[model samples]
Target: NVMNVIISKKSGQPTTMKLNGVVSTSYSDSAFKFNKDFAISTDTTTFTLEVTWRMIDAEDGSAYDSTDTNSFKIVRSTRVNQPSEGYLDCWERDLFLQFNGKPINAINETMNKLEVVFTTNSDRYKKVSVDITHKSGSTKDSLLALPLSENDSGFSGFFEREVGAPKRDNVLQHSDPDSIILIYRNPDNPLDTIRKAYPFAISKILKFPAASYFDKNADGKVDSIFIEVEGPVDQEDLEKLKSSITLPEPRKFKVNSISVVKGGIALDVTEQSNEIRTYVSPTDKIIVNSGSLPAGGLIEGNIINVQDKVAPVLLSGTFFSDRQDSLQVEFSEPVKHFSSKEPILFSHGGKTYRVELAENGVFSKERFYTSKVISVESGSAITEGDLIWINPAAGIGDTLGIKQLNPENRRVPLKVQEAEYEITVRTVNNPMKPDKPVPPEVVNVFGEKGKKVPPNGVVIVVEPKGEIKNKIKMDEGKVSIYDVVKHLVKKDIEGVFDEGTQKLYFIWDGTNEKKRVVGTGTYNAVIRATTISQKTNNRKTFSQIVPLGVKRK
Candidate 1:
């Protein structure tokens, strides 16, 4: 008899196998086998066994030959499987095993029990068992043994004890091991048991702090917020963190940047396009969806707070009274350290005046805080086209002690109005007809026709009309009657300025200062009045001259 065993892979190793065995007629019914001491290479899983034998009669040399071939697979060893790494199920808040070669049967709440169903073709093993073990210094300690039961595909069971802790120091602990020892036992031969250990690790979710705040401008309000998290976050984790934030309805925050800060990762939060900077208030609560995070951890909400560090601003200054002597200064917020001695500057008629606040004038009204009605001295009246501004050198401040520094804040252009005046002259008809009516005419002392006047006299009237209700001065020498031919002053008329009527009345009567009628071939009447121009704050003199003709009766 001849027998040959061939290994499927024979590139670099021996393929044929030789066996020492014997077969006899006395044991014709028995099977021939190789010696138990013979060993087969375990480098390959498939092998082929072939046997050839010849039979001959007792008297003849004739022979009958037959060959039989059989193929089979070898069980190398028991293994846990490939891809032994474990993952953190953040949504479930549990450590999940990612096994590629086996199907998961069940997982208990305590995470101590794990059942896996494996498929196999061999029937030599009677039962399967697993040992959950970890290295304790130099020795390996078996935490628990899971004896599996017979199933459709293979054996599956659960461990009786827990495997890992609820939390870990780091998010991923690659150094630690939570491995499984797969064991395959043969009932026929206990010494042929197979056991193998596969090492793996369990990663836990990352946790972050619960409080953050941002005051970029250091103002008394919150400009933005910072949400801290673990560092070295990739783009995928960044998008997840952004979607996990929750704010109140209509109030939204955007992630401006993800940067590595001194402590950890920082998510800078700012306002959206439609939102304002002050959308996040002090002591506001923000919910973080822990399930959406990459790793599993506790849901510690973020608490935001606002801090103030910016000074107040002076907004504008305006004249509150029609007289243009009272200025109202406004501030962006409530201010302090402003008193009656606060030096405020005013620009009027190309001149600068240092003014002070009126008594009890520091008060707030309307929407903004105001230094109400600062009274300018009568001699330095601020009027139309004037300017009033508060300089930073004035040392004004808000309640928080932040000083005002912007010069444009309190600068205001005043629009106070000034008074307007008109002059009219009334002359009598010819002296022969005291009650007769005569036609009125315009006369210019510079050579225009003069208005005919009777010996009785002529009356000059000046009317002041404007927003200003105060009376103007119209004293003697303000209205002068002179002789046009001689170019000499004939008389200085005295006029009465009436505050009630806002008018100045002067009766010339064609007479000289000696109270006598003067010859009036062509007498000139000059009227001069002084007024302050509100635009330039400059004193201006207005003059009007009229020539009169004296008619004989």
Candidate 2:
């Protein structure tokens, strides 16, 4: 028997046959089978196969002819029309494929198996076998593969597989491949096979770099640990990554969240076990068991330095009435900064005053002092028995950023009278001639005998009250007496404070510093008293003028 075959594309108009062949066939057991090899154009969408057969009997010499025509739809080859980049989950040792637009019939009931071969740069190939099952509701255009689980044995007509350990290890050892090939063979014609190559780049390989601990308040405790990586981590893979991190014994941490930073992903972690102690130590090794990262471990970071945990103590507060009436507070240690949510209060005459404290101008290495001038809005004087204390909400931060705790109602030790000194002046005529019995007179008035002296001298008595007895020391050569007798005569006269009488006496002679007696005239004696406190060593000066009339003898 002789047979002829022809194939033509079915379109609006009948086109020429793209393929034609002739073959001789034989029959066995009343059945005839013939095989022919031919090539068809890829652009053909639908084609019709026509076959004509002629048979002749050897004895009768009669010929019989038969013709048959059949139409077949030409489906496109299995190809990766839209292939997305893939990422490797280092913790789970899984490769995630996000490709779409593959032919729906790539894996069907007839051809129920698909093989994806990943060829590395070293020319090593890893074949992934995917067992496909037909689904009723599968779309006709494309097959969307759901994420594959490790236990999934069969999937729908889509490529989904959990890579084996050996093949994954082998593939990871070498560099990533430039492309991957999808192989599918037709069950009807084994010789007709489809192999589609797509650009396959393992865009990101998850890694765990050196981690750092952070102290948000600078209190020498770890608030969070940031783990940087080279790729983006999905939310589903976060738990796996969290489980892969191993901390030293007795130290525990929790991975809170993952965020994208400048370079890569950051894993925010907090200490879960210890609050007082640090979460991690310098010597402790932080190991991340991931397939893509280095197997050695992460680089250890510097340990956080422990700071002074003790809060600053309020030592003493001294009230000063020197140039400005201020209250100075001293602390046990140096203070870096301080602030109060409410006002630092001072009660004077049953009225409250807000005092704002600032850094003291004087520097002391041993301690810290904050000074604030006390001023009442009601003009009430800050006296003894009046309260001066800091608010409870005041925060006095030390050099190590530790704030003072429970400062509320902490009274400052203040002696308002210690800073206050009262001065009274009295003059005596002919003080040099004590036997003459000259009476003492108030320095404010010029009496007949007190004003008209014998031109010898006058005695000025200074009585100071308060804590200025032996602590009054003159600083920087400040003259205590000035006799104005038609000229400025500054006398360097030293006076002794008699503790018994509670008085300081200074005698001014009729002669100036030149030792010459002045002509008979009225002279004014200016007395200045400078007193320094023993507690704070602060100096205060009081001045008084006494007028004396001198007559030449």
Candidate 3:
């Protein structure tokens, strides 16, 4: 027999190795080491081999076949070749190369079909790079057969270069509440440039992009696409924004019912024409305002979210200023109390200035517009944010208020103070100033109606323009010397039952709160007696009038 080493065991004898197939066996650690160098080979048979090892911590666990870190690679015969040999464009022509399936271009290891291979390294990356030598000797410049797509079994779609970046959304969501022009950008464009900006004028022309892709081409029927969606928090850069962003508190916006006028938002509601009745929803209530309600109707508040932006201003310097006169407070949001700033500005020129909100003119007793000549002279008052143009001679600091436009609609932020109303007194009779003893009327939350009372005693609740200084009376061709006044003198003056009209009617020859009646006398007079729901505006409005005409007295 050829020379060989055999390790044998005998009964009650120590283990020994026989060398050269003869006696005098000297055991060798070298022979055992050489044995380990070669892989074990067995008779060709359909069988399985398992490798088991104890982990550093976990015990008694049998290792799996895949637990072996050692691996092998099987590359395709025509994976790469110089142009001189032959160009293989099969990978580029077939989409199957991108997929992990049969006839794969590359393999990491040898395995039987349908074999379950466990791996100790849970995290493993298999990457392959193809290098086709284009130039070889005299033959130069060769084309490579590159994969058109790549598929990961874990993900639904394959990663393909030709498909390019994801198609960005073409449909635009309205972002600005006030803007007439909608501005936005294409979602897929790396530059973030606007694909389409719709102006309010061309709403009909713009159509939403077709979303046929959203429909399922898979299964030849409708099916939900297996999409890998991620929340904002799950994004990588989102953590950076967390520290920088300051989220505002959510607030409940109370919607007030709009008061409608006659003739479909008519400029004048007097002619007794077609009426426009206001309808209030369960979540809404009417708030009667002197100004007109919007013609288009109420807009939703949800669309206008919390806005926070900063605009530069001129505190004391003349930087980008029109004059040392006016300014505009560009706020992130439209201010609640606009046109009431203690200091107003010029929208054209950036300038900071102090303003006189009171009638005293920095020293007058009256406040706001009342101090201006409009309250006393022509009666034209100046509201806050009115451009105050200073005449050089008036004084170096004298700021004369002038009319001007709000720049970019960026008006002054209104200064919010304690809520209160201002009433103006117009006309009263010459003689009975002290005799007019009346309590201020308490208007309900609806700005109308009074309470029901017990019998015997009578009370009158009147809403005058201002405090009645003297008995109210109108002027000649004004609401002055009239039968109503004559009737008042007969009953109130003599304290006798003058006429039936005097008992129920609040007759006035047109007069204002000041008791100074005018030819154009417009006054708000309230009288209380016994009124039913029929007479009132369904528990809304209270009294009626017989035209308080003040004939020339």
Clashes of each: 5, 0, 46
Give lDDT tens digits, candidate 2, residues 236-262: 555556666665444465667765565
lDDT (C-alpha) at residue 49 in model 2: 49
Provide the lowest-lDDT 10-residue window in model 3: 1-10
Q: Which tens-of-lDDT digit does each residue in 219-279 have in candidate 1?
A: 2233355555543444456666666666433435566766555554565655443422222
**lDDT of candidates 1 onward, in order:** 0.47, 0.45, 0.22
Would you list the clashing residue pairs of candidate 2?
A: none
User: Which regions of candidate 2 fall more than 4 Å away from where they truly are?
Assistant: 1-316, 319-419, 430-456, 465-486, 534-538
TM-score result, candidate 2: 0.31
| Candidate 3 residue lDDT tens string, 303-399 | 1121111121111211111112222222221222222323333222344334333323232221122121111112222233333332122211112
TM-score of 3: 0.18
RMSD to truth, every model: 22.0, 21.5, 27.5
Cα displacement (Å) at residue 60, model 2: 62
Indicate whether candidate 2 or candidate 3 has the larger TM-score: 2
Best by TM-score: 1
| Of candidates 2 and 1, the better by lDDT | 1
